[model samples]
Target: MEPSPLGSVDKALLTLDALGRAGADGTSLAALSTEVGANKSTLHRTLAALRHRGYAEQSADGTYRLGPAVLGLASAFLAEENLPALLRPALDALSAEVDELVHLGVLAGQEVVYLEKVEPRRAVRVWSAVGRRRPAATTALGRALLAAGPLSAGPLSAGPDGGTPETEAALAAYTAPGTTTDRLRAAVDEARRTGVATETEENEPGIACAAVAVLRAGRPLAAVSITAPVERMTGPARDARISALRELLPTVLPAGLAVPPAP
Candidate 1:
């Protein structure tokens, strides 16, 4: 059956999504109109409604961004769900065992938003924060989420030539050799097969991460990762960290969770 036409409210939501993809710099009215393919006058009215309810905000220079209302909604959801209450013990255990930084994150559109950070004392410091967003194609956590998702076993070769500028930079920034597209494809394929993904100095210089998805009933709930400095993550150390994660996955995930059949 054909989908129904979008209502006024739905159009406004489409505008909202475009605004989010614009990021911290915000989006101009003309760009938003172009993005949504709506007439300028109609988009103006839609944005006006969003602005009136605090769901969107126009800056002094006429760029729009998500407003406080979205943050309020996110805060309420996080508080009510209390994810830390359910996962802190596992995070703490992993952080203590590995003596490094552990993170829990979930996919938000094409980015992964960090939900929590467990930092081991005296570990190499990093700038990752509780709400920071990182591109999914570059980070271990994001790759794990994508691998466990419906796109499992899919190829990344069909994108625009050389990928995005940001993606190109990440793909080229690996410390050691072998950051080729073939290597990335093999890693992602392995992640889909094993539920684990690894990234080395791709997201940030001097850091390496290994991640595994936290699944409930065969659906990805979030991704958990252990990150350490490059020096501390080489050879034997890297193998041990990966081993520790594999050993802990069943323990951390809820017991008796259903495993869905492959499509």
Candidate 2:
């Protein structure tokens, strides 16, 4: 004989699934009872348990729906997964289509950490590796993230000493001599206006890059970039690369990952 299902747990899960399918309008108790194949009294007890735990909610019309606890579960799940693994397919496809290197990065303090990299079959390739760190103010990936969100909470903001030493250090480390805070701010503004960020021989010599931030719920979660030789990243070629990114990235991104709207 087959092992029996955990009756209460199974009923609760079925109810949650049904409520999710019911959408924003929710479902009535009778409908849920019919859907889950449980008696009204039994299902009501399950729903009460769910509600006590903040997992299900009953509206004024007596309809049941998913509650805030579902979002908390999703957030916790995402937080535990390896981000690079989750985004690898999109980066692979992008690299193949653009015939260049693609990178996935996330901001950490004043630096951007390279979490993943996908390279095309080209002989001349950018020299980069996973786990590498770069200053956020000069790289395309970092700039894209900065442009997508506010700077007040990060190193860009003035410190208690009333000086932006961290910001200055980031720029000095990755940018050319004499590059100023105003210039970096201008680049970020340009990125916000165009829906992408660019750097031509700024972060790495003889290299150019263009990047866009990956967002979730209007907040920047990470950034993706295409990198190529400086020659292939200018004029018509550069426009074509950026266009490919804007058109193709959204199609491959996993659920909950989105590209910000273009200005």
Task: Using TM-score, give the best candidate's number.
Answer: 2
lDDT, candidate 2, 111-147, per-residue tens: 7899999978986556899999888888899888887
Residue-by-residue lDDT tens digits, candidate 1, 1-263: 55438678677988989988898799998999999888899999998989899989999999999888987865564451466566778888888888989998888776788889899987475778988888776788877877777445334442657555554444344312324555655566667766678888887789999888777646777788999998778899987888767886456554533222222
Candidate 1 backbone collisions, by pair: none
**Index of the highest-lDDT prediction:** 2
- Superposed Cα deviation of residue 172, candidate 2 (Å): 12
- Compared with the true structure, the alpha-carbon lDDT of candidate 1 equals 0.75
Backbone clashes for every candidate come to 0, 0
lDDT of 1 at 142: 77
lDDT of 1 at 79: 51
